[model samples]
Target: MSFDSRSVVLSWTPPPRDNNAPITHFSIQILEGEHSDWSRYQSISTQNSDLKYKVPNLKPFTVYSYRVVAINRMGASEPSEPSYLMMTARELPSGKVRISEAYSGKPDSIFVSWDPITQEKIHGEFLGYRVFWKAREEDGELSRQADIKNPNQTKISLSNLRPYTAYVISIQVLNPLGAGPSNTVLVTTKQGVPSTPANLSVTSVSQTDISLSWYKPEHSNGKIIGYRIYYNHGRDAEIYTVNTSSDYNIYNISHLMPFTRYEITVAAITASLEGQRSQPLQIMTDVAGPG
Candidate 1:
């Protein structure tokens, strides 16, 4: 007729007087508070064995009361279980931990870092972690693994990774009861020859503009999408964009201040991330005077 614990299960049987006859249906109702009106009424066929139902998606840390009634084909029967106290689902009794950052430090490895969960109000005991990760291809495919146990250690290094690959990481907590869900995080590894632009040359200089080009590395594993060209005559830096047709050759950059030395550098941009800068290229424009 009633649950002994705070579980959100409702159970009932026929009233004492109606035990001999076949019960037609059962009705269950929920009241909001001690004096509030009933809010929900659910009916179940009598043929259902065990006569138990689970209430879902209820508010946490709240009180509720339930009552049940049995019915017959002729008319509705009297209430069986008058009322009993029950509680809804409570929030997870664990601390809040977060994976702060993940990145590639070198060519073939990645580092993962996280922050500790410091909540002091959790009643449940401390437990280990469940780590989940997926490797993504350049063509947009995702592969996932079931929850895997992680040691209490805060940082982990993943090695033997391929160049120009993207991976997603996630973490969750586990207790005696079960493991919670995971929160998603993403990271990408460095690709080909550590893109660095250097040794820029000015092909032509003019009063208001200049033409420039740079040498590309002989070999690289990563594809260079474009370049970020930076130039500064004074305190502020000006920017220009150069598109890469193919990594086989040099880039021509134009525009400048006449009779001034311009400092320039180039950065390699990939599909997922930007590469390191090349050596700085410095050039001085030709002087302009009365013709």
Candidate 2:
């Protein structure tokens, strides 16, 4: 049997006298709020001798009693001792919403930011905070370990995540004794689209074809890099593609029909990533000069 300010848990072994008799069941009784009768609060099969239960949202400084009984083919054993106890929960002060900004976005990692709790809540007591997160794949909330006592720093990063997925997050305040409720938020990672290319312009135009050049956008965070170029003679014409590493800035199309009107576009690609297409730039193939 065990007692705390919040709950009572009791367990016991079945009597050896039931060696030949088949075991039957177990039961738990709660006597609370001026009740003298042993009401059947919960019950279990004989295979289960141990019973654990909790009563939540109880008033502070209130006492409660709990008892358990074991039943088998032979009969029920005498009820265990009635454990009476008072509960004491930690105190927390209320305040406005405070939080830290989430850190840089990554395919597999993210950082969270937050401010420290008000000192008034600390009053001779040590306090901490909790961060809760849930990946898109999971159905329930995942919580981080208690942060450093009276944490002043504002940022925490969660790493080792799966790519191309969504995540929801929340934060909570806690003290030496217990934790406060959580604050919730949502975030999604970069999935299908790539970054826009920079410095795009027509590099060359001729009777038969046109060449284009563009600079790859700078990715300070080190993502995979590549580029995709798209071209067509007109809005109704078929589009063709050319893929190249980020180092390649120039593309030439030599097979266009002479003197034909053409439209061209460019898009940047990352390592295993494809981004939005750049604005389409149109150019008319020069009329075959003296052809």
Candidate 3:
């Protein structure tokens, strides 16, 4: 039997030695290479149905072997000879596409652009490009699709997106031959100041130092580069810390007055902006330790 360039179809007849028992089904086993395991590929339930089976999704640059086993009331029969071979498609896709996203100034839109593979590498007749995206949020996932009918089309602007939300995206090129593998990317819509950090607390305190911890914002629109720390008897009177990735959850504050109480808060930071401060946490340092 024949399958696609990267796959093969297999068929076989039942064993002659039935021992007066009727055949029940057949099982196909596959091995990608000599060192690979013989795993059951597929099973057929009908005794005399289409004994043929199509096995697809084979890698182009690898070798494979397959065998078949017949079963009846007694047991399974001896495995058949291994049919081993290599497969290749008419033209595999070129892995030279680039994808990027940028803020489009629209609060609910982003500009997505991509460069097609070089013409020199496109072995098959180009058909078009298909772009797929899914947004993941607290409630659930939402999916959207877009495409360019012309193979030469390069850029597309996606609108009506959620601000400060992330979208998983990928693109694949299609040809008369088949659809090639996809290039995937993650894009976070433009973000604004994040919500306040959560669960701020005082982990430890001492005569001259205080330790503080806090959870990240419930929704961090983009990658959190670091955090800013503020502490003073008053509201962030002092920029206690800045540009610190020091474990967003914990921070040790040294150089505090003995037997003194102070107020502190934290803010998450991204590439270009600092988020709102978390609720204040108070720390009362113990009296001076025995010097």
C-alpha lDDT of all candidate models, in order: 0.60, 0.59, 0.70
In model 3, the worst 10-residue window by lDDT is 40-49
Clashes of 2: 9
Order of quality (TM-score): 3, 2, 1
What lDDT, from 0 to 1, does candidate 2 have?
0.59
lDDT of 3 by residue, 1-291 (tens): 565556777777666677888777776766765466666344334344357777766654345677788777788888788776544344665554577544445536767778867633444567678787777654365568886878667888888777677777788876666667788777777866666787888878889888877777876655677788888864436665555554457778888788977888788888877888887777788997576
Clashes of each: 2, 9, 0
| Candidate 2 RMSD computed on C-alpha atoms after optimal superposition onto the true structure | 14.2
True-vs-predicted CA distance for residue 88, candidate 3, Å:
39
Question: For residues 1-291, what per-residue lDDT tens digits would candidate 2 score against the true structure?
Answer: 444445545555555565676556676655544454656344433344444444443333334555667677678777777766433343553432266576437776777777776644432254566666667667764644436454665677777655555677777676555665566667665443555667778878887768888776543122435565666655555544555555547777777777776666666655656666777786777777672
- Worst lDDT window (10 residues) for model 2? 88-97
Expressed as tens digits, the lDDT of each residue in 12-124 for candidate 1 is 65566755666666766665444555545444343443467765444443466777766665566765554665544344544445788789886676787777554231222
TM, every model:
0.35, 0.38, 0.42
TM-score of 2: 0.38
Superposed on all Cα atoms, the candidates' RMSDs to the truth, in angstroms, are 12.1, 14.2, 17.1
On TM-score, the stronger of 2 and 3 is 3
